[model samples]
Target chain A: MGWISDFLLLNDPTLRVVVPGVLLLCGMSAAVGCFTFLRKKSLIGDAVSHSVLPGICIAFILNGEKNIFYFLLGAMISGLASVLIIDYLTKSRFARNDTAIALMLSVFFGLGIVLLTYIQHQGNASQAGLDSFLFGKAASLNKDDLMIFGISSLLIFLLIAFLLRGFSLVSFDDSFAMSIGFPVVWLKSLLSVLTVWSIATGIQAVGVVLMAALLIAPALAARMWTNSIIKMLLLAGIFGMLSGYSGAFVSYALPQMPTGPWIVVMASVIAFGSLLLAPRKGLFSQIIERNNNEKKILQENILKIFYHIDEKSGETQKAVLQEDLLNQRSFSNRNMRKGLRILERKNYLSNHLGAWSLTSSGRVEAKRIVRLHRLWELYLQEYLHLDPDHVHDDAEAMEHVITPEIEAQLDVLLGNPTIDPHQTQIPSKDE
Target chain B: MNSNDLWIVFTAIAVALICALPGCFLVLRRMAMVGDAISHAVLPGIVIAYLLSGSRNTMYILPGAAAAGMLVTVLIEWLQKRLRVQSDASIGLVYTLLFAIGVILVTAFTAQTDLDQECVLYGEIAYVPFDMMSIVDGGFSAPRQLWIASGLLTVLIIVITLGYRGLYLSTFDPGYATAIGISVVFWHYILMSMVSLAAVVSFESVGAVLVVALLTGPPAIASLFAKRLPLMLLLACVFGVLACVFGYLIASFLNASISGSIAVVIGVLYAFSLVIKKIFF
Candidate 1:
């Protein structure tokens, strides 16, 4: 390993040549991957990659085996053609986008297979290197291949920077961007070409079949953690680079291990990690928030009963049986104890001889919750045209959730109604 | 050309008919890619059978190819469901990988044989007739690819025709079919296996790419002019025969590879059909 590093540094097998070269190419790829992810067009890469097979084969037939330049050019043309055909067909009536991509991917790749078979039949030794292009053999890549990748990565970075705003605007809202004088159609065509270029650049290292994952995985992973376009782009690039390096390292660690699928696996791990743990949008945060909300609601439920009993008879001193309240709720006695503790802490209700009653502060909180609930029910029934039965269930949930501004607004809008639709009293301010 | 020349066309027609029978269903199910996938995947199966038998026995290779085809179907389906990746991505991933593996193994193991990847692609259907079958005292018999293909096509046509209503109902709207109590997955597997078997038989003659074209193009061409299922299937057979016969003759006259030219011509024909339908209709 040390000797290899020494060689790459001194134009031998040293770290200087290998590490920096890999870093530059991997960094640019991950950056382009960010845009691809935000656009949600992963499979476009799949269509383009599979489409390159015949191109390389045709190049060999026409130019003989030695010309990497012509072969790569041919590969790029056919790869772009696959993308165009997919876009053209999917935009039409009969076929869907996914299905169109799948069809073209198979057909062109099949054609490439047939041609490669012919090349193999002739017993040319050059055909030996062709299969490596399927899953990508980054280690087999030489200084010549590295130069092509370096130039392509630079071109991609420059092009993206030049059109950053235009891409973002068009990606988010094509119609709005068009109205504002952007060439939405032309810009989109440019993006499509970029996708093909991305596919072509990665083909030598990642190979055809697995290059789609590189285009898709980093972008997908980036989306999990951000809303800001710049942040998303940056994060996506980071994920892409890390996945590339890690996939490269893993392949190095295990001899003969394919780079493309492993890179994809690494990207997927990034995506899944963000999916479970990213702030605000993370699944765990959402679940915890929801659980806390439900706990708070259960505590409020006990205070509500006391307010209800006093409302019917204007008898504030009645001691309602805890057993009776338990029957009315779906919560078990264990849950009720927790609720009672929360209620007692707030001085909402006190337990006396196993009976529950609300204190004065509790009565005010209960009346307000009930008022907000009925207001929402009225709002839904009036504005949204919901069924009264549906309104009750919805309002029951919304009642405790309205803010002070919403409560005031509803009060003014409803003309301070004394009774709800069910002939029950709709409590007001100062009640 | 004599009456014997008719056998060449007749045997081709028989092989084409068998391929087209399940092709109609494949096109309808949108499993046309699977037809191509299984066709290429059959390389390993044929290679394995050849290894064990030391002979290219139709008895051995038929099941071998079909088994390999089904394995691909199972692999793609399993990967798609288990990985939560999109179906198209999974299909593309599985087939290319399996095909590549098959290609590598072929070159590595049977390097001595003339069975290169290109022969596997277009297949030597023109050469199918020469493979020595059981020679009789009375008369000469056809190579069994024709007979086996004919039988498979017949069984496929019968199965599809019998279950036509159920198949159509599910294909048209599986959600609606399920709502009406049809077991979609049961009918689905039947179509998968039928298409797999058909593609396997056709692979040795037409090769893989043409399998996709035959499966998709004829039905697509028929769909342009015909509305009924029976009409579509029948016209597709006519279109299939036309593609095979005309495709072969044109390729032979040009001295081009039969399967590549046939597939390209089918693409051209499909495009032409669309153009004509557009301009006239």
Candidate 2:
């Protein structure tokens, strides 16, 4: 309880400075990240982050001091240069975008490394802790840094809010947006500027090496949960803030740990968790749905087999031996017994002496299944002009999925046909 | 140059050639970032292997790091295929996640050890010549990195020689190769394994960050200048050797970090080539 209060109370001044700054930075980056992810330009964020390193080094060299404003300005300038270089490479047909990104990323980072080493050799006391830009030093963030982040974060939020429609339009359909007179190019540049701003602001916390993760992971996680862009932005912002808070807490607890990598680690867990467990599109849910579908198909096939047995005997009800079913279809014996037991529990089958007979209630279900099968067969032969033999296979597959409503529509559409193309009598309703 | 300087330059050249060889295939496949992924992803493997085996033996660390490298490839593939994450996004996601885990593990267990994160990021290649391993019971000795890099270089040469045809077929036109009954999937894993091996070996000398630059930069420059495969391979090696020679010279004169200078030198060479090609062609 004491530890919880200590963590959550925000009594420490460092926490007050670090927490809001990281949260705002993460939320803004994640929001802008949605557009980049949709644009399939995720790695471009990576290139831009690395490109900013030389910018910071060059700024420190030029100013002979570590000023936050100069750093941000230098970062934005180099960030824009990286984007322009990538654009030139691909647009001029010199290299593919990925190659261009990789090229720019490594080259700029190398230059930054060289410049950084030079600064270290000069033995300037002001250059102390400057290398933290490689892997950030979030704990050193002060009230002034927080103020900068606060203003920039607010500006990014309002910009994204105001331009949501334009961003989405351009992201989803660039040519369509252009055709609709939405100033697609201007919208694109605006979004790029927003991305560059967030990245420049973020480098002080997350650093250049892992900045792309902050820009991408939250949105990647949020996209797994919802299809709507608005929900995606909201959820991503929430995830980013949660990760930011937790990362700061953990880093504060353990003195050796860096907050930037920890934050990314937390975001990844949420993203992977969402991918594996989110409803509708997640891996686990999809597996469950597929298994249920297979089970349903098995149950329907068992019912159809029982109807065929009664039809062959031309009797109202007949008890068929278990061996007879095994010879009719090649399903597993274990599955056959289980299906029989399930049917019996439903009051759809009666079993005595290892022979199964369809009860009255079961007869009605079996009759409907056969009716759907034969109706589909007739519809295919008459309406689609498919061969009578081909219609049987098509109808066999379609019968299980045809709902009661669809069955009624098919009956009306087929003019209440009494016999199928094979001259088999279609079971009437309530018969 | 003195003998120590010669060994350092040799170590750099060996690391360069080993990385640039497979890097050509990566660049051709448009998977230049995969090299970046493997470099960072190998961190956890190195740490865990050291913790488990209680030795910094290459035999133990190499397999552990190589396995970690394979995990990066497999995880990226799984996310893209099963979760429907975009390919580039999956690459970005998996490597960072693995890398962050590696960073945490290092800070947690090996904080006191010499395997600090700073050394891992930009390795001290100038220190390579100081760690000499005796080859013949103190009769003949070489730098440890020289032995590992050259041995790996020899193995790489053998693998490429034996499997050259299949590697070329799969990398260029996997669909065509698959249609013609070549095992494209099999070749892909083979290439990935080789990439993992090269990345781990290079990790010792160049460190992780510059390994990406070394693996990708030279070959990227090579692709711009060469039309034929053999020519590209030759040009990549030449460019790598040149970067090492010039980078070491510049670093020695300035008393700066050799690896950092080498990376800058490669970028300079790339830009230099770009200009030359522009002017001539």
Candidate 3:
């Protein structure tokens, strides 16, 4: 409790400076990241981040002192240059976009490394902290740096709020935006500028290499929770701030831990967490949904097999042995037994000794499935002009999926057909 | 040049040749960023291997890092194919996460050891000449990195030579290759494994960034000039060697980082290749 209050109350001066600065940087980058992500230029953010290294080095050389403003100015310039170079290379047919991006990223970072080593050898006292940009020095950010971050983040937020529609339009459908007489090119440039600015400001916290993660992970995590662009932006910002706060807290508590990687690790944990546990789009939910769907299909398929067996024997509600059911359709013995027990529990089937027969409710349900299957086969044969043999496999898949409304529409479309293309009697709803 | 210079350049050339071979296939497949991802993802493997072995032995570290590289490839594939995540985002997410964990591990556990974050990002290639290993009771001595790099180069050359046709067919016309009973997925993973091996081996000498530069840079320049696969492979090796020589010279002249200078040289050569294409071709 003491530690929690100490942290939340900002008792430490370093925490007071680091916390707001990191939160602003992460939140803004995450918001801007959604645009780059929607534009399918996520890797471009990576290229831009790597490209800023040389600019920082060059800025240090020119300014002869570590001024955050000049460092950011140089970073934005080089970052934008890298983006333009990638765009040109992609457009020039010289290389594919990925190739161009990879090339630009390595070349710029390499140049930065060269310059960084060059400055290192020069033995300037102020150059001592420049290497910090490589991995970041978030714990060392001063009050001036926080003010810069606060101003830059506020500026980015306002620009995004004002041009939200245009940015989204360009991101989702640039050509459509162009067709509708929007300033597509300007909007794209504005978005890139915003991305570069956010990245330049944020890299001081997370460093150049992992800055792309800060940009991409929060947006990706937030995307799992919402569909609207505005909601995605807001949620991404929140996720970014949460990760930033936690990363700062952990690093502060444990003095030896580096702040940047921890921040990235926290953001990734949140992103992967959302990926696994989000309600609709998460992997866990998706797997569960798929399992349920497969179960429903399997149940419907088992019901259809029972109807087929009854039709073959020219009897209704005849008790069939387990072996007899297995002979009709090759299901795993385990799945067959489990499916049989489930059907019995639902009152769709009744088991007497080892033999099973469909109940009245089960008969009606089974008849509807067979009707849908034959009706689809007839519809495909008549309307699609598919071969009669090909129609059976097609209907087998559609029977489990066609809903009642679609079934009625298919009935009217097929015009009350009693016989399928295979000349089998099609069961009607009345029967 | 002195023996020290000769050893450094030779070691760099070995690293370059090994990277360029698999890199050509990566460039052909348009998976340059995957190469980048593998390079960064090998970090944790190197750290964990160092911790387990209690030494910076290449024997232990190479397999660990190579396995880490393969994990990145598999994770990216799973994310894209299974979860329907976008390709670039998956690559970004997986590598950065692995790299972050790697960085944290390096800072936390390996603080007392020689393995530092600086070496992981941009390695100390200049010190390669000093880390000597004497075989046969001090009868013969050479840099251990040179030995490992040369051995890996030989293995890579043999593998690439033997599997050229399969790689060629699968890379150029994967659909047709699959139709003709070539397992595209099999060849894809095999190529990814080769890339992992190359990246891990080169990582010790040139670090991760320069590893990416060597992997994608030479092949990219080679493809601009050569029309055929064999020619492209040969040209990529040639360009990689040239970049090593020139980069070493420049680094020595400026007293800068050898790997960094090599990357810059590669960038220069690529620009020159583009200019020649523009003017003459």
Highest lDDT scorer:
3
lDDT of 2 by residue, B156-226 (tens): 88988888888889988888989899998898898888889988888868777788888888888898889
Task: Score chain B of candidate 1 by TM-score.
Answer: 0.89
- Ranking the candidates on DockQ from highest down gives 3, 2, 1
What's the true lDDT of residue B50 in model 2? 85
Model 3, position A181, has a per-residue lDDT of 95
lDDT for A218 in candidate 1 is 59
Give the candidate order by descending lDDT.
3, 2, 1
Tell me the tens digit of each residue's lDDT in model 2 across A266-335: 9898888989999988999999999888777777788778888888889866989888988888889898
Off by over 4 Å in 1: A1-41, A87-99, A273-303, A310-322, A329-365, A380-391, A429-431, B1-159, B173-218, B234-269, B275-281
Question: Over the full model, what C-alpha lDDT does candidate 2 score relative to the true structure?
Answer: 0.87
lDDT of 1 at A109: 70
Model 3 residue B189 lDDT?
A: 88
Q: After superposition, how far is residue B18 of candidate 1 from its true place, in Å?
A: 8.9
Candidate that beats the other on lDDT, 2 or 3, i.e. the better one: 3
Query: Residue A339 CA error for candidate 3 (Å)?
Result: 1.3
Among the candidates, what TM-score does chain A have in each? 0.86, 0.94, 0.96
Q: Looking at model 3 chain A, which ten-residue stretch has the lowest summed lDDT?
A: A293-302
Model 2 chain A lowest lDDT segment of ten: A92-101
* Native-to-model Cα distance after best TM-score fit, residue B10 in candidate 1, in Å: 12
TM-score of each: 0.73, 0.96, 0.96
lDDT of 1 at B108: 55
